[model samples]
Target: MELELVRLPNGVRIALDPMPGLATAALGVWQRVGARWEPAELNGVAHLFEHMAFKGAGARDARQFAEAIENAGANMNAATGYERTAYYARTVAEQAPFALDLIADILFEPHWAPDDLEKEKGVVAQERGEAFDAPDDRVFEQHQSALYKDQPLGRPILGTEAALKNVSVDTLINFRAMHMTPERVVVSIAGAFDRDAIIDTATRRFGGLKARPDPEREAARPQTGHASETRKLEQTHLVFSWPSPPAGSDQLYAARMLSEIFGGGMSSRLFQEVRETRGLVYAIDSATDTLEDDGRLSVYAGCSAQHAHEVAEVVRGQLELMAAKGPTEAELKRAKAVTRSSMLMGLEAPSARAEARVSQLFLRDKLTDFAELRARMDAVTCGQVQAIAAKALEGPACAAAIGPKAGHGALEAFGAK
Candidate 1:
């Protein structure tokens, strides 16, 4: 993939990747501010700010703003993550100007109002409640607390109800003014579009953004633990974590393979041994979360309350076995193929490309195109996988489980014996 990158005098970046015959385009503004950017008092304010951005901006109120884009075709909506907030739009190639204008309006010209804040608080609160009510989601929250301790990274993106109540209009506006600056923003567009026209539109919309320096964000504090609590639920939800490589490191390639082979797919060792073989879990998988300074390779399993202890033991044993013996050459080959297939499939969509581009640039200030990324994956060896598994095992393994079971959600109390 060829990239056309430009930095405006004000420090805002523009990345354009044109797919010649595609009929639609996706453009998004990626900002380097999220829950981690907030202080303890303002736990979920970043997310609230994201909600408020859509409440009103410029002349179009939230309803009109959404209508304009939907009328033009933006089936996909904006999203907020732990490290960034993205406002993106997809529309006909010719509607590029309108889409960018509307998205930029959301990103740069939010109409902060006390009324909107009061109303949106309820919506955000409801969303938070829903997340807490779901056992799968609750398990991850418990896991985050165990893995990140009292740090902001452990704070839920939706934040607590108390935090939302404390957020006033001034806090919202000031936070945006401080973090939503040119130097910390990346504008990315992909699919069929006029490059020159898109550039001019971005400059006009974002050029006036001040190059205000972003304050240094708090680094995520790493943590480890083994604790569980009782919840009157039907099935047990388990989230276990170990050490892994940070983002932008070559070890990430190996980490990806480790995660996949560990418990990723149907044919994975854990899924085969714990589920198909033992009927231990209804759903099980391995996932990784990598930040600039810290990372985790975690496995999640939802099983009958009676089988929680057995599931945990099997998972631990799989890691130990892999570390000692390493993945077979056939397993290594399959992992690489699965990873490549997933990446290639995601590339088929313009929005995916836009998100990938912004993420790479925001995290590392460089985009590793398909060829480079493929080469990295292609270069991973079984030795690296074994070494990663061994090092991961050396770290404290944290376990968090939520369910009403024989042990009342405590996997450790269930007796490893």
Candidate 2:
């Protein structure tokens, strides 16, 4: 794997990882700001800004933006995450430069028309409603809100209906100016391509933009204790979140391994014990989400209203067992192998590689080679995994459950137990 980092005269930084013989190239422009950076009044501005980017730019309107890329036989899309927003394209190796230019134009030249803003407000409002109607989605949102409490990081990415309604053209334009700077952006490319030519084109196009000072971000600290809510639905969706180490910590890897062992796959302990053996529910899993300053380890389950209480106890029991006895040597080996193989398989797609590179650069400030990542996963031992699990599950876990009002007792009992 060859990695080259280039800085344009205007301050845009581009990183290229060239993999020879791959037919398709993945490309992306990632901004440093996301939902967490928005001011209280502009809670959803980052995501709203992402939508406005496709409205129009340069000589291309929204339709033209789509047509121009499809004309080149490329697939393009964008996504907004907690801490970043990314615009991406995957195309034949030769069309990679055009994709990069299109992305740059959209990012720097979006024409935020008042008419479009009005129309988009309705669209985002509908989106907000849709998300709220989905029990699973609302449950996660409620969990994050409960876990982080008053922190900006705890807010929903889709902002409230009132906030989305009030987002004017000027608001989005001001947001663009504050957060969309070359210094905070990263352009990453992967696959068969001329690395130097790609960098040169990106530099020439994006290098003209002036860099702005990085915006201030709120420092996020862990919120201890528990929170719960009751709702009306069929199956209960429960999420248990506990504070964990921030990204780049050695414990982060251990926590990930622990998640895999506990609930990662069909063969994982949670799946086998909860869903397979007990027939407790259709889905059960655990995940570790680590940020720059703080992180969370969550165990999620969807179960019948009647089984909610028992399932929670079983899940906690599994954690307690892990804390006491630790994972066996064989289980640790299998979990590590599973994680390493999954990582290797995911990189086969150029688009995945591009996203991975941009995420690493933006979130962790470190470029990780696949080999090094695999080695790190391989180095996690059973003892370290157990210790991390014990630390993560030691205290009162925050719980959020959404289902029929009848199921509230089960959830409340689970928390109390």
Candidate 3:
């Protein structure tokens, strides 16, 4: 695998990864700005802008845009996240240029039809409602608020109904001009594409934009407390979060190792103990959610209201045990195996590979070799993992729950009032 990189005179970065013998390709334009960069008044304008981009751009209406891609046998989509917004496409290698053109059109030549903003706002309202109605999703949203408190990071990416109502075409246009500059954008393509043509097209399309100062963003301020919502559901959804190393930290590999051993899989501690052994919960898992400036070690479980307290206690016990003594040698070996296999498996897919490239460029400002990643994971010792776990437990944990019990005893178990 070889990666070709180009930095245009205007500060736009283009990365091309050539995968020989593959028939398809995946490519995208990823910007370093997302919900966190949005002003409070425009909280969800980024997401709304993404949805509207497809409605019309260049000389095509929404129908024309859809037909263009379908006619070319290409797929196009976009996503907005906490720290980034991506416009991406996947298609046969032969259609890579057309796919790229479609993406470019949606991005550079957006045509916000007069009625589109209102309709999109209504659509997003439905989206926000659906998310609010799902107990599990609602729990995570509450957990996020607790984790970041009053910070932008705490706010839901799906802008509130009030914020969405405030959005207009001018709002979207202003937000784009502020954050979607050349300096914050990366154009990446992977798979069996004509590298020269792709790079040339990218340069011609993206190079004209003038460079500007990087967008301002608030540093993540992780708070530790409890957030809860009561609802009459069959089972309680509980989430526990602890502060952890941010992205690009040396301790990240160790932190991930700890998560894998703690609850990443069926053979892991939380699953085996909380579910298979004690049968306290039907589902329990742990994951490390890392962003550029902050992260959290989170554990989630679904169980009967009656067993919520017991489940929380068990989870706390397991976390403390992991932090105190680390994983057994067997557990460590298994974690390494799981992590290594997952990395390898992801590398086999063009879309996954493209996403990884974008993430690496954002985090490390360069593509990290696979061998280097594997080496780092292999070098994470039990002591390192233990240190990461113990350090996270030393701080206050954020807890969220939504259900019949409203996390009555669960939050108390984690010492979150």
Candidate 4:
């Protein structure tokens, strides 16, 4: 893939990942601020701001924003994560400029009317209630809370009901003013498009935006101690988290492979051993979350209340075995192929490319070429995977399980005989 990096005069960074023969284009604006960046009192403001962006901007009202993208024969949406919020639109190559303009308007010119803020507060409150009611979602939040406790990283992106109720137009507007500066944003375009023309458009549209001093953000590094908790539900949701590598670490690549081998797919050890062989779980997986300073390796599983202990044992056993004996050569080969193939398949869509470009630029300040990523995956070895697994899985770890009262005892057995 040919990648171009353009820095506008106003300090906004633009990354273009052009696919030569495609007719579709994906464009998005990515901001570096997210749930983690908010002050404790402003927990979910970043996410609420994301919702408000679609309410109206410039000449486009909410209805107009929807119609304009639909008329262009495209899909438009946005999401907020632990580290960033992204607004994206996908359309034909010819409509790329319009899509870009619409997104820019939404980001820079939200109305944030008082009535709209009141209405959205109710909507977000409902959304928050729904999340709390869902066992899968609620359990993960519990796990995260226990794992990172009292830190910004542990705070829910949706904030509390009281917090959401108190969020006024002034709060959101203040947040936008402080965090949505050119220095903290990246604009990305992917698929068939004229690179020079897109960059020119971006320069004209975004080049004059003012830069602001970035707000002081809390440092997320320095290991927090392990913690755990129990809750009431039908199935037990167990999570194990330990400190790992930050993004761009040499060991980070190996950490990715380790996560895949443990639980990335149906063929992975966790699935094969916990579900297929023992019928202990309906879902099981492991992942690595790499931030700017520190990272975590987490394993999650949902199983029958009666089987929670067995499931935890098997999951822990798999990691212990991998640490002691390393992954087999065949396991390493399959993991690499799975990782590479997943990357290739995901990039086939214009929106995927656009999102990928935005994420790379925001997180790493670089465009990740498919070929280079594949090469890196191809080069991981069993020794490296085992080394990372041992390092990440070592020492006491945190676990949170939400299930029937009967399952409370299972928490005590995690990483235990």
Candidate 5:
């Protein structure tokens, strides 16, 4: 990977990954702000800001923004996450200028009209409804809320209807002014491209923006335990979350390795034991989330209400066994292969590569190339994996469940609410 990092005079960090021979490239404008950066009263503004950005910018209306990008043979989208919000596009390398211009316009010259704001609130209301329409998705929100309580991080990214109604045009404008500074953002591009040409285009487009101080984000310390929402559903959905290390910690990768071995695929321990052998669940998996200051190792399962407790028991047993005995050499090797293969396969896509590079710049303040990352992955001993499992699962576990009212008793017996 040919890589270059340039800090423009305006404080924007620009990273270029010029992959040779590929015809297309991906670029992203990543702001070092998201739900985590919002205050209590402003819970959903970051996500609301994302929706409004697409409504219009400078000389372009919403339709013009969409039409221009389509005309340029590209697609553009944005997402708001716990620690970062990003806007991205992937297209022929020659379309970099057009893509960057549209992105820059939205970020730097957004138009937050009153009509658009009210219309957007309704749009987000519908979006939030769709998200909650799925029991599993709704349960995860409750689970996440139970983990990181009384903070911006715990709230849903799409703020509640009450919060959305409270957001005004001035709020979005002020948010853009405060958090979306050049210094707190990164512009990254990857795939077949001329590094200097792209850099010049970025400078010309994003050069004049002034830098603002990055907000002081309150750290997220999870308040663990149980929370359950009673709902009428055929399959009970449950999530168990335990504390883990932060994004930049050395233990972060170990937690990931441990998580994958525990429940990553059909071959994983949870899948085989809980799903294949006993047939307790249709879907069961474990994953980890690493935020700027904290993280979670969680398991999710969708099971028949009558047997949800059995699924949790099996899940608990797998964690206990791994924490006590650690993964076997075979398990470790297979997990490494699975993780490494997944990484390599994802890097084949320009969009994935661009997002990874930009994320590294935004989060780590630097990027770890594949070889170095692989070396670290290879160096994680089985003992280290076991140790991480023990430490991560040692804390109080937070669980949230959505199912028939009758199954609440079963969940309580399993130490869930």
Candidate 6:
């Protein structure tokens, strides 16, 4: 993949990925600041800011902005996550400039009306309620809270109702002014496009803005504990987390290998032992969540409340076994194949390529081409995977469960240091 990068005088970084033989392009503006960067009082301001972006920006009202993008045959949306907030649009290659301009206007010329602000808060409150209403979402939120504890990282991305009430037009404007500065922003586009024209447009739209000093970010430290909420559900939803390598760590590839072997698919240990053999769970899987400075390896399962304890034990046992004996040569080979195949398949889509560029820029402060990313995955040995698995057992585990109380104690028991 040939990725082009250009930096404006104001420190706005632009990355362009030219995918040959494609007629459409995917593009986004990514800000490094997210839910984790919010102050205690402004817990969900980052997300609120994302929603407010579409309410009105530049000369376009909400309806006008929607119409403009649709008139151009483009789909534009935005998302807020724990580590970053992204505004993205997909369009035919010829309209890439228009998409970028709209995103730039969202960033630099947002207008949050008083009525809009109040209405958005109500919308976000509903969003929050819908999220917690799902058992899986509730369990993961509990798991994050258990792991991150009293920090902003632990808080829900949808600010609490009380906190949502505190958000005003000034809140969105100040957040944009402070965290959406040139240095903290990255504009990336991928797929067939006029590279020179896109770069010229970016220089015109994002240039001239002054850079600001990056705000202080609180370093994340995972805490160990267990939390649970009882609900009238037939199945218990459980989540388990252990400390893992950070996004920029050398051990990151190894952690990925460990997750794949542990519970990545039907062939993985958790699925085979906990689901196929024992029928302890309807589903079980493990994955890694890595942030700039820290990360966690999480395992999740849904099962009868009576089997929750057994499922948790079996999951822990699989990790211990992997740590003790390491993965077989066949397991290692399969993991590498799965990891590489997934990456290669994803490259066919412009959106995937755009996301990869944004992720590398924010996580590592530089572009790591696909070759290097695959090489890192390929270089991980069985011993390295084992070491990462062993390291997971060294920390206090974080656990969360939703459903009946019968299974809740199992999480507490398993989570105890």
Best by lDDT: 6
lDDT of 6 by residue, 1-417 (tens): 478778788888888888889999999999888999888888899988898889778999989999999999999999999889999999998999999999989988887798988888889989988998999988999888878899989999987887777788887777777886888889999998888888888888888778778888889978878888998899999999888998889999899989999999989989999989998899889999999888889999999999998888888888889989999989999999999999998888899999888888777778778989899999999999999989999986899999998888668557543
Once fitted onto the true fold, the runs of candidate 6 whose alpha carbons sit more than 4 angstroms away are none
lDDT of all predictions: 0.83, 0.81, 0.87, 0.79, 0.83, 0.88
lDDT of 4 by residue, 116-187 (tens): 987877788899899877777777787677666788888898887666766788888788888878888898
Model 3, C-alpha of 98: deviation from truth (Å)? 1.4
Question: For model 2, what is the C-alpha lDDT against the true structure?
Answer: 0.81
TM-score of each: 0.95, 0.94, 0.98, 0.94, 0.97, 0.98
The list of candidate 5 runs beyond 4 A from truth reads none
Model 4 residue 300 lDDT? Answer: 83
> Which residue runs does candidate 3 get wrong by more than 4 Å?
none
Off by over 4 Å in 2: 9-11, 225-231, 414-417
**RMSD for each model, in Å, please?**
2.0, 1.9, 1.1, 2.2, 1.5, 1.2
lDDT per residue, candidate 2, 1-417, as tens digits?
588777777767788888777888888888878888977777888888887878878889889988999999998888887788889888998899988888888877887899898788778889889987988788888878876778788898978766776688888878888887887889899888778679778877777777767888888755553445567666888887666677767677788888889888888889999998999998889998877787877888998888888888888788889988899888888888888887877777777787788767766666888888788788889999888878877654677788865555554554632
Q: Is 1 or 3 the stronger prediction by TM-score?
A: 3
User: Roughly what TM-score does model 3 have, to 2 decimal places?
Assistant: 0.98
- Error at 404, model 5, angstroms: 0.8
- Cα deviation in Å at residue 322, candidate 3? 1.1
Worst 10 residues of 1 by lDDT: 408-417
Query: What C-alpha lDDT does candidate 4 achieve relative to the native structure?
Result: 0.79
Candidate 4 vs 6: which has more TM-score = 6
Off by over 4 Å in 4: 221-232, 415-417
Residue pairs whose backbone atoms clash in candidate 5:
none
**Model 3 weakest lDDT span, ten residues long:** 405-414
